[model samples]
Target: MTNVTPRSDIVLDVQDAVKHYALRRRGLRAPRRSVHAVDGVSIRLHSGQTLGIVGESGCGKSTFGRLITGLETPTSGTIRVGAHGVPIAAAHGTGTVQAVFQDPASALDPRMTVRESIAEALGKVAGRERERRVDEALAAVGLTPEFGVRYPHELSGGQQQRVCIARAIVDRPDLILLDEAVSSLDASLQAQILHLLERLQQDTGTAYVFISHDLRAVRQVSHSVAVMYLGQVVEQAPAEAFDRGLLHPYAVALRSTEPRILDEGTEHVERIVLTGEPPSAVSPPAGCRFAPRCPIAEDHCRSVAPDLVEATSGHLVRCHKPGELTLSGVARADAEV
Candidate 1:
């Protein structure tokens, strides 16, 4: 793992951001309800750092990514790229942020060649300059200039993904939102992409917001990690702390379930198996959202929502019994890269 100093300059900052969607009414008399996709989430990222966000499907990971990339507006709160506040409905050409989606084919134009697709993202640069940048981008991702003439359909899955990455970085945006950028690829390809992303960040000093369900991949690429549940961040800490132990029960439960962690053994800390499905975001519980499924829930946890409190330096957890609980983590043996 790389050692990162917390910097004062923030490439991305999100404060109390919320994105809610109202469901269609079943009848005129029926009361309208809204799904709380992202509820009061706040995060910050420094230049050249990657913040990994991990959660189950429908937990609003994608929505948050869209919010940061300016694809979707927040219902409330603020999002900033560098020192400037990002306006709702802002287009992608602002040169502050870019996004790489899970599906490379969907992100690319079927009719456009790789060179054209990359040049389009360059946004107004044309002629020799555009061609130069396109070739440079392709080379940055380990692709030859010859591949630029090929269409998306002609390339393999990994090569197409490399093209998508080249398109994203060609703009040289300050921040990049990677929404499951490696989820579609095989294990070997995923490793290659992750390494490429890390190298790009080191070379360009660009920050990244990586959203994925793969915990191991998250650990490998991120400088810090945030665990979200029911549209809220439950725990956040430096990447090293994830293996040392996480304070939030939900975070601990997640780590305990990892096959690698269990195989290496967690005899010192208890394994908590949660029951029941997560409550709907449209009708989430009044208190801590994970309380219904938490193993250490108490009376207060059921009635009052817990604010994120720093249990230790730079480690935040939204749990009523923050430091009182000792949870299993990925054993040191399994944590070896």
Candidate 2:
């Protein structure tokens, strides 16, 4: 793993961000209820760093990504890019924040050639300058200028994704939200893309918000990791903390299930099989959204929501019992054999 030191300048800052969608009324008589897709989520990303968000489906990971990229406005809270605050009504695809979606096929317009797609992101730089910028963007992602004339259908999955990445960075945005950017590719291809992203960050000092359900991929790419449940962050820490040990019950349980950990034969770690589906976000549990599925829940945990407290240096967790529990982490080589 490469050593990454986050700079003092915060590239992205999100505070108490919330996004809700009201469901259609049944026959216009039933009381309308809303899906709390993203509820009071707060996170920060620094320049040349990656914050990986991991959770089950419908956990608001995607919604949070949308909020950062200005694809969807927050119902409440603030999103700031660098020193400037992002407006709720800001247009997507034109901000200092850009996004590379999961499906490259759908993300790229079928009618547009690779050159046109990348050039469009350059804003008003036209004529010879625009062509030069387009070529430069393509080269940044390891693609040749010849690929400019090819359409989305003509490229492989990996090449199409590279094009999407090029488009996102052509404008030299401060931050780029990658919503499951590598999940759709094969393992080998995923590694290649991950390496490419790391190189780009090193060269351009651009930050990334990497959202994915694949914990292994998250672990591989993120400088920090945030665990979300029921549209709220349950735990967050430096990636090293996850390999050492986690404080929250939800985070510990989720990490134990990763195949990499299991294959390594880590001691003292039991496979935790959580029961019951996550409760509806429309009306989540009164306290700790994870209390319903938590194995170590207590009476206090059931009735009161836990605030995010720093249990260790830079490790934040929302749990009634923060440091009282000792969980197993990935075993070191000496301990493994």
Candidate 3:
């Protein structure tokens, strides 16, 4: 299937997918509650595109990544990768799509050398060809061929993560899911890895679904961005839109709180910190999940859930009142002066 061509358009498509796990309280008579990890999310990744998913922890970002990459089966809904039409569940271990997991060190085999680890994905190729491919993959990620002989334990955290990346890209799969791939790296190293990934996509034409909590990183590397809140996607838009505006309150709050350098000087951003912890997944609030914390919430927002709708060109938002800006109240009052 390596030489087989894929359709030149959409590379990955996920329909309204839902994944829930049962959480039982320690009571003989108490009823079990379900934790809705990923609740009805739909997304599309076009050929050679990078779609970044950003959210607070427990917002189901990683779970959604796992679902799209076929690491776990969804409780309900479908994921289709490439033009092969393979069921996402059936695609795991077969390498139709691959994942570079969060914990880079843990994801690699401590006992196996990097060469062997990458080769494991190739079924059973000749030793020479396998070695060559391993070298090529390592080089593609800025690692030399000699590094392939070293075990995961011998490599630094960044090197180890590159090994994981090499393994994922070695087979030239149609798509890759990067789940917090650079979260553990230092700032400089993270930028290097992100640049390498961008180059890899350009060189190989591989589609990427980048899952990260770093809004700045998402802005730097992604073509499009999707914001998830409490197991649902509250907004999705082109990367540029993140700077202009975000319709969902959760997305707006996240963007406001993200850290950034002030015009490349030493001065760093002072963030707009959000109050309170995220609500429990077992029982997300009725109506808008963010209603409890939303500054502009009205009775209608508290009484009914909002569906994701197109708010602008290529921008999708889930909000009862899309044009109502919470801070605009202050801006309007100031404007009258």
Q: So what's the TM-score on candidate 2?
A: 0.91
lDDT of 1 at 147: 98
Which parts of model 3 have CA positions greater than 4 angstroms off?
A: 1-8, 25-29, 262-271, 326-337
lDDT of 2 by residue, 65-111 (tens): 98888778899998877534444345354557888989999999999
TM-score of 1: 0.91
Clash number for candidate 3:
0
lDDT of 3 at 112: 96
Worst 10 residues of 1 by lDDT: 328-337
CA lDDT, candidate 3, residue 137: 91
How are the candidates ranked when ordered by TM-score, highest leading? 3, 1, 2
Minimal lDDT window, size 10, model 2 = 325-334
lDDT of 3 at 5: 64
Backbone clashes for every candidate come to 0, 0, 0
lDDT comparing candidate 1 with the true structure:
0.86
